[model samples]
Target: MRSSVAVILATFHLLLFSGFCNGGTVGICYGRNADDLPTPDKAVQLIKSQNIKYARIYDSNIQVIKAFANTGIELVIGIPNSDLLPFSQFQSNADTWLRNSVLPYYPATKINFITVGAEVTEAPNNVSAMLVPAMQNVFTALRKAGLHRRIKVSSTHSLGVLSRSFPPSAGAFNSKHAFFLRPMLEFLAENDSPFMVDVYPYYAYADSSSNVSLDYALFESSSEVIDPNTGLLYTNMLDAQIDAINYALMGLNFKTIKIMITETGWPSKGSPNETGATPDNAQTYNTNLIRHIVNDGGTPAKPGVAMDAYVFSLFNENRKPGLDSERNWGVFFPDQTSVYNLDFTGRGVVARPPDANNTTISNGTSWCIAVMGASEADLQHGLDWACGSGNVDCTPIQPKQPCFEPDNLASHASYAFNSYYQQNGASEVACAFGGAGFRTSKNPSYDSCIYATFGANGTTAAAGNATALSSAKPSSSTAASSGSDFGVPTRGVAFFVIASVVALLLYL
Candidate 1:
């Protein structure tokens, strides 16, 4: 009986450990202003496939929430600005909203954070005034549902909320907005929630390229701007921006509140006049930023602190109104392929197929393929573009050819997309067939299906009959492998508590 009891205790300990929080260095914003984006299921799959663990969505859309259920992806869902007045004016409204929108999908969906309003200080004063009240009501509702401990409540602000940001130590909020911000900061501190803020080095660099070195803004080279007050050395604009915010919080005497980066990213493409918004610059900025945060602690001012950051967006939002740069801040195209290869774990990008002798593929490796969740019609359309407009060889996928026996949209499109992807220097843009294609790390070759891939020698070949294409495992360097919260499996504490009680009763 004692032995059996010992085994039960061991199992209980395993359960508790499984529920412990996992850490992640990177998260992505899931913005859906574009109509051609993949279905929610597909998008979530893509996120998981990419080994992404944390995601922030603008609203608690039912489809999106339902899709994320049981996926272990921690979400920070939002309440739209329009709902602020209603949520704040009446506790019942907030309660009802949570009951209907969130409670139905609570633990299953892993909704860990709630943003009452985004950039409230940037809104009209009247709207900004409702922010805290709405947050309190939401928090109350979560408490009533007995979820306040797990699902945090907070709001996101633009750096525009700060009146001063230079000289990291001199950071201070615009005095005019202090009336609302001070109380908001208090609420965040009381609730143990973070003061979320959007920081964009891209904007800073664009506005004053002469003043900001491109290398410093991109987290490269080294920061020459040292704050005289703190005598701290700075290496990147982002760390400085974060320190500025920290200084601002310290100025207000709210030193205990944590900081969360709600959004930050560079645009891969923009209007002709939007200089430095090229793919190379975007890649450099995001890659280096990810590497810095993953590999190091906090900035000079707040060294050793582990900060939470979410990249601006997953896909370019075509319908969002603003400068061309605003719509182009996505790291991915709508088809769910990287705009550029990124190593979220601070390691360099690894090539596909890897070398025969070594596990890492050479830098020149590339492949083209249809995105997994693309529609049949979209797949056909993309295939057409690749063969006709893209001028990729489609002979292998034609009737009676090696690849034609599959007679499927995905197989044929993969062949054609791979061909186009290989021919066009295997660049990211080569696979974008209006959001129907993506890049692959695994060679998508199968029996009698001769897909094209760019080898290290810069030559293409039909590798004849081979095993069915294996799906690409996420690179070891992806953030998930290093223990992201999304990779953690969560079970309600109630389960463990109940199990312990039951085991005790049985043992006695």
Candidate 2:
């Protein structure tokens, strides 16, 4: 009985922690193949300012690794294709590389993954054969340093390795690449590492725009494509592409391994022949992609399975040898200004129309509050920014203070957001929060907890609108649907708590 209880408790804990660890996450690829880009230290600041928690660098540049030390940003570093042969031929080479490139600044740098080679199947001089050997050598070296379990060792592949990805269900690996891919998949499964791949819906649509609808590629599709074999309805091309990879993995009986999108993005500019590459399309794709990932909008094949992806990339590389679109995939320019405004937090819509003076303005009386269904993580991000960097006085929402009764994420976030909004002259940009907040004409004051409003004189109490606000209370639909108080339990925390109790009872 004790053994059975122990097993049950172990499984319960695994399930509990796995859910938290695997929650949908977004990372940016820090590709520095440009002449005028900011230095690594400045780049770190830029990433933090945007609330970006994860970043991937193509190589283990000492300067870049040093810059990330103690910044709390998880990094995915890489090994170039040229080094694969030496790493594969001798374990000592891998050990030396790790000692010089990684070991000295590991835990401080937060290096989560070390990709052995990127897209080896596409590399020249038949490097695909060396991919698995290189990964094994790297893993062995890390194990020698007692770091194998902490930093995952793997390689990234391009979609060119797949023979067919149509309808998603019929996905399969190309026969030629299977020799290396099979062992690689087995290694990933055995070590609990993710199968990294670069997925580009933009390439698919750009290559065959006649067949792929712009709406589908942009995640704006109203219709769905039903897979005849599995009856899975795919609403967007990105999900379908991921599901296709999932199906391919399943075909090889590697169902335990998860997929990580190492790179995915749309370009803001392109050659005339490039059908759908434009600033608007790029913005729409990335914005929707962030929203989808952060919301845990899993593909139909793996519903509710939170996946992590890295957007490519942080800045456009002027020296990249390709079409104009190739050099224009960045969300930001070298100057640190956004190529276009993006909400890295994926909380709210990120559309800002500036006036003639290039400043955001508000037309009428509006209050910025947390959106009804915003995720707890997103709400917390917005709240932290509002109180800290946003320079909002968040005293009223603290313990034993006004507006502290509800004591929930939504309520506190609403208070903080409104405070920031009112202080910032009620500009539309002030309420953006990457889409976590919305401008509501409805006054959200109730009882002693009063929201502030911007006035010609200065900040003023919203009590003047009390009579009008009485009829307009924030809806409790989100809380009721979620079976939590004020929608506070996010990402299935309540469910995990209940499961924990049941497991404890069984153990007792």
Candidate 3:
């Protein structure tokens, strides 16, 4: 009996370890704005195939919620901005919406959260005023249904909530929105819901290239920007964005509220003069950024806590308004082809074989992530050798963690040409080796890539600025290892791309 109990207990422990929040999480916001998009059922298949555990859709599309049944993907549904008045004015409306729209989907679908509004503070006029009341009413209705504990209430915001973000330590929320932001912060803090921010480093860089270096914004260069007030230095834009949020909460004395990035991405395509929109820069930005998150160093403001990020979008939103970049934030194209590359634990599934290696580009680089089968032992091995810790065998086999591409490196010209060749029946040579993935052909315009970033030590990032001199590109012989490795070669000519980027940095 004792032995049997031990076995049962061990099994239970294993289950809990797997079920409990053990570590890093990868997710996406499935925004279906285009008319020609696939059905929700097909969408579910795509998300699940990519191993994405969390998804945030703009609305509570019943079809989407129903399709996710038994799939075990966590969801954060939303209440459209238009529903605010009715939801806030009548508790009954909130209850009915829950009963009709949510209750039918219940535990079967794993509806973990409901965003009451999106960027209310950033919204014009009284929209900001109505958000909190609606959120509260929604909370009450969920409680009456006894679903409050199971489902958290929250909202997403834009970085415009912060009045000043330059010196991260000195971050502060705009005073105009404080009336609503304060109580909302308290409610979230008490309820254990995270504060979400729709942060786009690309926008900051695109709007002000004179002030924002492409490498610093894309996690490539190590130019430090100091906040005159806080006396803190920020090496990258993402880190600065997070620090701005942290400082804002601290400024409000809501320092304990969890900060979650709801949206952040680099556009794969954009208008000319959008200085850093090239594929090489896009890959480098995302590749290095992913590497930053997979490891221990949280934002400099929140050390020890693993950062939680949902790469802005799963697909390019062709229908979205605004400039060209607005519609190009997807990691993949509408047909489910990856736009750039991403090297990390998180990778999206491709419906067909790409012609070459790819990356999770946000619009500035062309990096490659490791193949999905990468393990921590492999990562540690790479880190050991790369950092001169002397643990890696430095063998010619696959690397443990995903490596990055140099800032201006062009693994492929543009996808249009590759697609042309693929359509013409030349798929083999079309697959080139590089960051995040091996795809047919990539657009010359987009170079941003996403790859793994591991800390040399448990506490600090592996010397920020992946394109720095310390990060040398491997040789060409190694670069052409095999077109089949969807991930890039961490040991060849690709490695020196970082060195070249660093050489460029010296001149910068």
Candidate 4:
């Protein structure tokens, strides 16, 4: 018995560790190009309130750095392209900038990466030539301070750096940027830093909607596209984009270097020509992206490798000089109210406040349905919580129950999540099972299994006017972005239960 218990315990711990390792990091980009943005202190508070663990800023603003001190959020600071020339010409300039900008708050602020420049290849006056030198000088300053290993040095690049990205396997860096890019790639590889690039599947689809499907770009594709050269299957555009970068890196014989998404997001609003840039699309893309990364849904080229990404702009910067989409990538408005519901933790859908007007569900009535693409593990977590602590009446989902046929985790979880939501007043908060549940106006009732809903007399019922409700389904297509199922492995759950019992016995 003791040996069996020990084995069970070991298995439980291994599962837990593997799950942790597989969940990649998600961070937000803090751009302050707006005139009406909140102060740094308030911004930090807002970030923390959302349970966000990481953030990246455009420049080394002292006020912003100071505000993040003692907050425990991992920060990535930057250097503008204009400063690259001065920093490259003189090592002392780099040292001085570091001293004034980073040295004081560092360990307290949890500063992780120092981006030397932003898209230097796109900058005027051939500033790209100075990128590597600037990075080297900054790295040297950190080394002198005994902080080289603690703070990584790299630069951010746009997808334009790649000359070709179609089919992903054919990705290659532009020869025009070869002189500087090669050396920079070498520096990144040698120092064990990631090749940071801004990947926007929105652009790929927006520029050529005829060739690229919105479903593929938003991670909602029920179909897969096979890369002919590598024969690797691509379910989403983001994965294809990253793999293209990976192939580009491998072509240079830099296989060991990792890739990071410095900036990526969809706009809630855009110009008339910027097709598919609606609030619904933005919400779907970002929400699914968080789930993809946190669930370790790596690209087809590197399926096992975990990737980290920072969503562009925490707040919409109205002053940004570009298309209207550029000003609307922010997840939250300046007032700190989210532009739409988003769960930063990648667990379940975040519930919007009652007063908020961005919800997709109609004001009349709503039902909580299991989001289509939620992973099996996520669905299980939500289901367990709903049936257990959520005080949901899950009797209808058991064997011999009306809802048991079609017998799958998705159907069962939907019934339970909806039951909980209806019983608890059908508020958005009740439906939020960590991004696992979404509110829908369409009735999910079939044959004998009727989903519970709040009645007119303020009571919950298992029956409702199925046809009277809206004919449109929930954002099922958008939720299908992950294409994840609702089945949890039974062996893992059994191990967890056994381990728990053994732990309690030992404690007694």
Candidate 5:
């Protein structure tokens, strides 16, 4: 009887919060694209333990659906792209699939969304054409079963469907796919279902690491890229991607259709070339992502609009094909242990206000270095400022110079900042490059690039021809002579004295 009541309560929570929640709701995608995985019951237990309110699965697996019954976890189920053709061809096929899969345990299981096709636009067989028809048939089947209003139907799309996404405000769907996408948008609008998108900054960063900063991709950057046209300042890539999709939809005159992030996660491991696929990076990305969404601050283009997102997967699928990153998006290993610690509730890593002052540097030997986790753009910004305003000699970081062998922004910035800091008596003001600079106790001297350290006499010699600017604060005194008059003496005459004499003469 106690077990029965627990199940009933779980069911109640699922029913109430499946569509919307009081706090920021994050879901997990339980993809079983591998040979080894636990049974549905054990997976459900893990989900419950994490206190996750939402979950999405690749298929309408009967066992998984039944396992979720009375657990109160709302689910977004998917229909594979291969099955889309059959569903699109005939309503009977859709009804059969729905009856065999979803109808048996929907409300009890808390199924709220049925994604007909996953990223169909990127499918090789031109499955994009069948997405709308399949969605329609699925909707019709749900209506027949008297569940259309409760369960929304839509297909997940990749950002590749959009021809332009850079400026966010200028995002537009590719003209080639617009024929099919337009009708699909209409169907979604008519049904009030969201336009689901699978957004991944990892892919964008991987393709163009030189131009895109890692901090921007991971939602950890203090710097922002503003869309000039819309005056929208985008601090992270995910929000920019979402706003791009929204702008695309609004371009088509479908302003009311909402957007949902059906899939988004970072891989914990990958090939040698996949530089950003480390476990630490994965944790940082996922954790920060949850906090950003839960804070209820939507994208700049669509302020205050709440978002619903599902992390890519539950467990890594070893059998999955493609690059190493392809199989490692899971938050947990196959054993159900989390790959990295995460607070799904978004309270674990509370954001602190920006430090008003920079890291303290005692009057001892120290090397000014780049702050860890600072973005490439941020490093560049600081480097430029150090070389320009800070007046630090950066010749060592130039090509053919000793420090140039390392040839990276961070390394160069460190060398330059250290030179400036040491020259300026290592003052606290000189070391703070808008918080991008950090004072390192350990020497960062590497192979050919040796950083400078302070001497006992409080002044250090130059590390090879590097010169430093004076640390003196410029006086605010006005220029000795105004440039307006050519060789005129303004100090000898007083305007007030001349005015007084003219007034006295006039009175007499």
Candidate 6:
């Protein structure tokens, strides 16, 4: 009898888990706009521990892509607004960007979506004119890479895309934006991509509290707001906002196009004016929202068709611009630690806010994992590369890949310096900040390059430059050795005289 009960309990456990593992799950958006946050690669581990399967990042951060690789988290990457015009005009440029930024960190990071632009139609402050053309160019590049189907192309919009959202049925784009938005919607429909939105009921409520009921905004009371046209009573504000988006699509004559909520969440804390931002409200809103999504209940407008939602963010960004509520919407803190009691419905997040107010990096030469003491000649070669002398050349991070000029050389140089300064934790963050031109930057990751090429005892430097490199000196810290390296820490040997001096002083 005991054995039978045990077997029955085990079968029930499997059945309960089967649906969650097999079916599609909603993803969380981990926006990295903060000044202090862990490198993207490390962040991936945090998300995995939470059992998060999907994510969407604003731009293609190399660190983010490299970190998510092999982590089984599906990513939806974006191109910043600035790149739209140039990228639209040059397919080759897009290709090069992909090879340098996207290609290296593939399969390991299952990047699923390529967001073309952000709310181009209502982009009063951005290059709204280049919106469609940029989309076309990015789409073309995906096709050339033969990744069009596997990786989609779309854009997220602010609900402002609609001229009138209150009535739902009376929705339409402003005539000024119609020329761009109509064609864009047509493309999305033909391509089968979602019209993503960055929806926030908090914004509406904050904009006007007297009119928008706090209970409706918080999803608290049982009261409802009916859509004037559909007469569908909305018990919560978020659904009403979503239905407004659906009606906007319908008015454009592409009713079949799918709509997705790319960003949404309630802030845990905020200023006095942001009344709906209380902890109780946050719990009510998020708890109810998750339950809403879990139930897979569609809005009255599109009943039964499960909506795709990506929670606004993973961490509260201290550096974000706008109201206090803007930065307080994160589900986690800078350290990948959860801010509240979010269950993740069976998931969790871990984070390490990268050092803040850090200007100079730790001495990198001290950080090298040393190789066995090499001959005098080898040391000389390594020194030459470390100091940036000419003639030495080692394999770049990307092997066998033709190199392309980075977006800006000066920026890359600064990044290379910072990356080495931060050493162990900031490799990916440095790369993302460094952009594609990172290695070639004047302050290049010359030391790291050399370390990778030679042995950690700084073997590769000698191979890259014929002359002396300036930075890769021996020191106290060391990189963890990869493959066969000399036994001693490279830093210890390089700074032998200095170490001895410090030791003598301490003893005295």
lDDT of 3: 0.62
Give one clash count per candidate, in the order shown.
Answer: 3, 6, 84, 8, 0, 41
| Candidate 5 lDDT, 246-359, residue by residue in tens | 999999999999888888999999999998998867877887787666644457787546788999889999988899999999989988876865657553421111232335
How displaced is residue 413 in candidate 3, in Å?
20
Model 4: residues with Cα > 4 Å off, grouped in runs:
1-20, 350-417, 420-508
**Model 2: lowest-lDDT 10 consecutive positions:** 474-483
Error of 2 at 447 (Å): 24
Task: Put down candidate 4 lDDT per residue, 125-223, tens digits, no spaces.
Answer: 779888999999999999989999999999999989999998899999999999999999899988999999998999999999999999999987869
* Best-fitting candidate, scored by TM-score: 4
Instruction: State the weakest 10-residue window (summed lDDT) of model 6.
Output: 475-484
Error of 1 at 29 (Å): 0.2
Ranking by lDDT: 4, 2, 5, 1, 3, 6
lDDT of 1 by residue, 1-508 (tens): 6777777678777655544433226888998998889899998898887677889999999999999999999999999888999998999999998999998987899998999999976776568888889999999999999999999999999999998998989999999887788888999998899999999998898899998888888866533677899778786799899999999999989998889998998898888878888776787687667756665556778754667889888888899888898788887788777676554544433222122422322464556666545677898998888889887778877798777744557667777887887776677777777777666555445333546666566665543423322223222123222332233313446365557758785766
Ranking by TM-score, best first? 4, 2, 3, 1, 5, 6
Model 1: pairs clashing at backbone N, Cα or C within 3 Å:
23-484, 163-174, 354-361
The candidate, 2 or 5, that scores higher on lDDT is: 2
Off by over 4 Å in 5: 1-23, 350-508
Worst 10 residues of 4 by lDDT: 476-485
TM-scores for every predicted model: 0.66, 0.73, 0.67, 0.73, 0.66, 0.62
lDDT of 3 at 437: 25
Candidate 3 positional error at 132, Å: 0.9
TM-score of 1: 0.66
